[model samples]
Target: MKQSKKIAFVAGVASLALLATGCSSSSTAATGAEGSDATLTFMSTEPKSITPQKEPGSQIGMALCANLMEVNSQSQKLEPLAAKSVTSQDAKVWDIELQDGWTFHDGTPVTAHSFAEAWNATATGSNAWQGNGTFVSFKGYEELNPTDGSKASTEKLSGVEVVDETRLRVTLNAPNADFPKLLSTNPTCPMPESAFEDLDAYEQSPVSNGPYKFISWDHNQQVVLEKWDGFKGAEGFSGGADKLVGKIYTAVDAAYTDMTAGNLDMIRNVPATMVDKAKNQLGEQALYEVETASKQQTLQIPEYVEELKSPALRRAISLSIDREAIAASLLKGHAQTSDSLVPPSLGSYVSGSCADCVFDPERAKKILAEDGGFDGTLIIESNSASDQQLVQALTKQIQDNLGIKVQLKPTLGTELSERRNSQKLDGAVFGLWGWSYMSPDQYLSQYETGGDGNTVTGYSNDKVDKLLRAARAEMDEAKAAKLYTEAEAIIVEDLPAIPLFIPTDYGLQSQCAQLNDVQGDLQYYRAGYGC
Candidate 1:
């Protein structure tokens, strides 16, 4: 799960106040020829921050800080990056050994204390960092993130301990064979000492230990990075470009236009409207597509909503939608109809796991009648920034098939997030659940009682919770996957959310750039761009 940990909000126009008049530096444009000192420009949204923990999966942060582990794009397996080795016996207590000679951009050594202190600051409830949820598995996390909403007793997580200058130990509250895989996520990346001294200033332009060092951030215009000549790490870690430029854009369509015009080196998440024309316009070699395991569009039904509490009603809703048609038509075949909540790219996936997802309008009608017909219009809320055409199609399908009056509420992304966080949503909402790591637990664990990622849908089951716990502790990969599958089976029956579609990630590469490696689930930073 190399994608952003934040809810997969639909890409929308960035704030108008942050908009730049035009792209700066004509030299940054794609040259259509390889140059040793070339600059690669990528289309990107305005980043909220450059801090790894604060903005996990941010391209700027990914380029600025090297993580303890990285996912091999081809194998989809974890590999050591900053860390020399991450080992655990019983999957509970782990030891981490850092690679020698790795130094921060500020020229300070990236010692074990750098990681321990950073984790402590992120875990502290007072800090309220977005990445705090990632540290919940560590021992003594409760003391740092108290549920009572009172001040924490201590800022440090007792589980994180520095063994020496290069070695560190981590003790989780429970066994998790995927702990090392979790380290591959950006939130687990270490921060230098200067970050702790003044977090705000560090966030503006932080010191990091990645292949690229931050050069400048031009607010909403662009972020410039220069290759760190002194970078030392595993082979193939260094980038080909002398400089990388993340050019901020208010809209994806505009980015796609620039990419086709040869002004941009690479652009991801090609707009649904442009999906069909991209390959024809840019040629097949320039358009890249891959099935993504990290995220899926879903219709989340909160249990608190009295009208939608019945499982039969929810199942009927799922059965009503023609996912295949929607995927082919509205999405322009850029998405795959999801049969289960889990995407097919993961190991735990089982085809046709979501039996209710089948499109059978007569069965849906009968089930809806048996479950007692709705008294009022069904409202489907979604972020306006999302794919409204797909939303409109879904609403139309439900209205036509189920014979129920429906309303589509397209709210702003920020306002929608605020309403969701406060549990103030008036009806079922369309959203996405993205994983922090490449594990089934990332998807199934949300069904656990009061789980950290369970903010969208208030779903809970005793059997599912027990199965998830068992999966977490199981060291055997196959056994763990079985336990997770069992949990997913139960969740599918409960129908807390309707799995709509697993989108195929799409990107366009400029004629000047050649992608050495492409990972659909990860941000563009993970790919090697030779320009």
Candidate 2:
């Protein structure tokens, strides 16, 4: 269940090895109390990589590095972190001023140059960082990853104007109203020159500027990070523990066991089925429901499938699946049946609610009958056993409601992604792999004509494309939100993608160690502050 760069969005489909073993009752874990030197042991599903700019979105990377802006998990608001201030009169041009007296774990002064170098390297084709999608907004992004098969001509981005040691200017390719929110994400966190000097070594123990500094990483075992005494961030003043030690767990059930028994300080991603059980057994105070960035389970209906091309048939299929039933029965109320592609937790939430999204077996059957009844077997593939189980439940509902023959195929997570990317599947594909950012632009752009998340499904609409482009270029937040909402309404009606539910993080935290759920990411540092 190790986290991978590509597999992060596999939707909560982890193998929960539920062995009939008694829980261990150990109470010798360290608490995040002020003036108490403690090491918080966290049970983590291992990250695929810890390299900055390469796998910066990984949980390990987020825990170690401090970005220009820090997003409040609850509010989804961007606050200044490394940058003292970020100002923009025109959305395309932004001036970023770094906070004075901030230093990496290795004692290197964090400068504007550090960010420039890290981003430029990631954008370059030779680096092949999977996170390069984060930097596409940069002015010279296309030059770094040229479509013409030419080598990158520059080391520094033309849009980034270095003002001084503590200041720089960023020029986006187009006006993006949510540019500040983009900078707040972990992938945009600055990396010291030391990381670029020896990429492999940095991955092992990256010099960090956050509340915690990387100490050591034992692959597939544990990653150790100690509190930096010289840390000057706002989170540093808050009551954070002395150290963070992430112990890798192969299964969520085992991690949950350890956490409940007090052997581990915290365990993330408790299985959905176990939510009620954990809450009852461990007490509500011990159970945490963390709001993660909007990860909606969706069915990507490929355009290649002729039978699925019928709007009425697709609508029938969508209505046939009982999302609320699955959310309550299978998910144990851990998720909500989603109406819009954009989760309501975000800023640009659009209420795309419709009668079409409502489950009506009789209406669905009538619709299918009108569209020349779906007689062929509909095959759906998923990565994990849990997801397969969920799909099986949905397929059963489909068969009973719409009288459509359905098949559920289970594949390895990586294999599923490969098949999805290659467009090898003749049927529909389902996954949690969508936008990590809170922007409506990121959400809607997935279905844009030949966009990054669009190529697999070949789902496109001219109206949707026009609206997305306008939103992308709009400097006003209200105008962009309106445009995105208009586009979402069109897509929701067409039924190119069927939204099932929005994913929420359910976990357990010991009384000794606080669990801070920041924008869906569980953090021990925020627990220290009791925010």
Candidate 3:
């Protein structure tokens, strides 16, 4: 759910490349008054799809549709948004009751059927929606999306049943206490009947029920939204901006320049090269930076690499890199050195879950020698321009510390993703994972054998697989977290991927607007505007 270095990966499936989330304003009108008309603009890359279920993590989708559940920005707790309540007795069967009077932008009523139909369409294998993996636990998901790549036997999930216009019942394949957390995702948002009538047309101008409504989409340029005055949710238009405009820019530097010139209102990602200068240039009030809960930078090593399969060799490579130095000097303190696979934002995270993650060149060299030293060059691949510096720094550290020739290969994000999907990535790949919700399961589930996120690394441990499964089914919140923590211990021991850093989410605001804390999805929502 978290945006990758240059793209968003939904349940480990790579989607379109997206810019970091931030909003800017083109209008200079002082419009913070109760009903004053003002436009707030934001930086974004062109979205592949605006449909909520099709591209759940899209900034456009997040703005246009209200999800069943949303994370409280301050508390970081999952709470109801569109849905009045999500209740279950056994955690396997859930009943969702929608808040009455919620309507789509097109004036159509949002009902239980709206959610069921949208979910069914997303689950259908023939549709090939990237968000399909989110519904794997729903009963009949296998029939809808067969792993063998054959035609699906069913189009709808048998577990999702509309009890009435306002209520829906869902039965999962297993008891999952974290099921409610999943609802907070954009994919779970309800769709209007008009969307199903002609999906392609709907994608172009989606009829959503959120704080904003679709206005126009200038492809490769911008997508515009007007505040939906009929929004029934408790949170709506806090910024007082009448229009939310997402201006697509291929370069972050350009956006930052525009922001500095006062032409743009806000920007979520300050170019890595300009991170240090941003505070001095914009002042402390205008610059916002916080440790993100959903992001973790890592280096993934495929198990199929015979010469590097040894856990000791992998551990040595991890130890060789100086994460603290890179985060402080190279990244300008924009990132935190990570010791565990899970970020500290999650309650399940243990401070020192990854013992091998520490930097110890001597120990690394000793381990490499004991495990039969690696022969030949260690190639680390990355596609993102933002990650190039970090990747290069890592290669240098590995070479200097471990005494192995290291190469940093820069490829296009799309090409790198293809190689990852095909499991053809050779030595090591620099990547990052972002989560849509605040849950430890999002981080740990990727290592499960034959799991959605396991396609790239091909690292599988029977104990880890079992632990993840149990964690998914465990009803007790603390128990589920413990299981995930235990699994992380084994995963670090295996060293399929080395946790490197937890980067901070950065934003710059103009004097005209106020920015809220970055949401779990790593997007900055407007809290207020019109200074």
- lDDT of all predictions: 0.76, 0.70, 0.76
TM-score-wise, the better of 2 and 3 is: 3
lDDT by residue (tens digit), candidate 3, 294-382: 68888988988777788888899988988888877988877889999899988789998899888999999999999878888888888
For residues 1-531, write the lDDT of model 2, one tens digit per residue. Answer: 633111011101111111122221111223324445676778765565676566654656776778787664433455676777777765678888888888888898989888877777776766766566677778887777666878888776788888889888999877766777777666677788887778887777777677677888887789887767786654321225567788876555677777777777777655567778888888898887875545677877888887787889888988888888888889977888887777786566756553477788899999889878877888887765235556778779988888878887777554565576556776877777435556777677777875545655778899998888789767666777888888888877777778877767666777766666666656555554221
Clashes of each: 0, 3, 4
- Candidate 1 lDDT over 1-531, as tens digits, reads 433222111111221211343322222332324444567889876776777887675777877878887754434445677887877756788888888888999899999999998899877867756567678889979999777878889878999989999999999988877787788777787898888788889888888888789999998799999878677643234445668899987666677778777789887655565677887888888876655546788998888888888899888889999998888877887788999888887778999999999899999999989887776888999877546778899999999998988899998655676576557888899986677676888787667875655666779899988898889888667988898899999999989889999887666777655443423454555445444
Q: Once superposed on the true structure, which residue ranges of model 2 sit more than 4 Å away at CA?
A: 1-37, 72-77, 148-156, 236-239, 291-295, 301-313, 346-355, 361-389, 399-429, 433-438, 449-462, 472-476, 493-496, 503-505, 519-521, 529-531
Give model 1 RMSD, 1 decimal. Answer: 8.7
Cα RMSDs, all models: 8.7, 9.6, 7.8
TM-score of 2: 0.81
Candidate 3 ranges with C-alpha deviation above 4 Å:
1-36, 74-76, 236-239, 269-273, 291-294, 302-310, 369-372, 375-377, 383-385, 411-427, 450-452, 518-522
RMSD of 2: 9.6
Choose the strongest candidate by TM-score. Answer: 1
Which residue pairs show backbone clashes in model 3? 2-434, 23-42, 24-41, 24-42
TM-scores, all models, native as reference: 0.87, 0.81, 0.86
lDDT of 1 at 62: 77
